[model samples]
Target: RIERLEEEKKTISDDIKDVFAEAKGTGFDTKAMRSIIRLRKKDQAERQEEESILDLYKAALGMV
Candidate 1:
């Protein structure tokens, strides 16, 4: 059962890869898309806090 579940997970992962490939073929940026997806997974407050921290760090390093 565990092995079968692992195979199924791999299949789903492959399907995700195919979808990303198709999106890239259609002129979509998969790297940015992945980042957007990750951000969407976080709540507004959490995202805001992360961004604020990043901004502060960048400013500290004169990267802002």
Candidate 2:
């Protein structure tokens, strides 16, 4: 069962790579898309707090 599940995981991962490749071919920014996906996985308040801290750090470094 464990080995079968591992194979399934690899297949799903490969499928994800294929989809990202297709998106890239269509002019989508896969790196930004990955970041968006990561942010979407977080709760809204958590995401907002992270962004707020990032903005604060950027401003401190004059990156804003």
- All candidates: TM-score: 0.87, 0.97
Tens digit of per-residue lDDT, candidate 2, span 3-59: 999999999999999999999999999999999999999999999999999999999
Model 1, CA-based lDDT: 0.99
TM-score of 2: 0.97
Candidate models: Cα lDDT each: 0.99, 0.99
Q: Top model by TM-score, which number?
A: 2
Clashes of 2: 0
Give the C-alpha miss distance for residue 64 in model 2, angstroms.
Answer: 1.7
Which digits, one per residue and each the tens of the lDDT, describe model 1 over residues 1-64? 9999999999999999999999999999999999999999999999999999999999999996
The residue pairs that clash in candidate 1, if any, are none
Candidate 1 TM-score, true structure as reference? 0.87
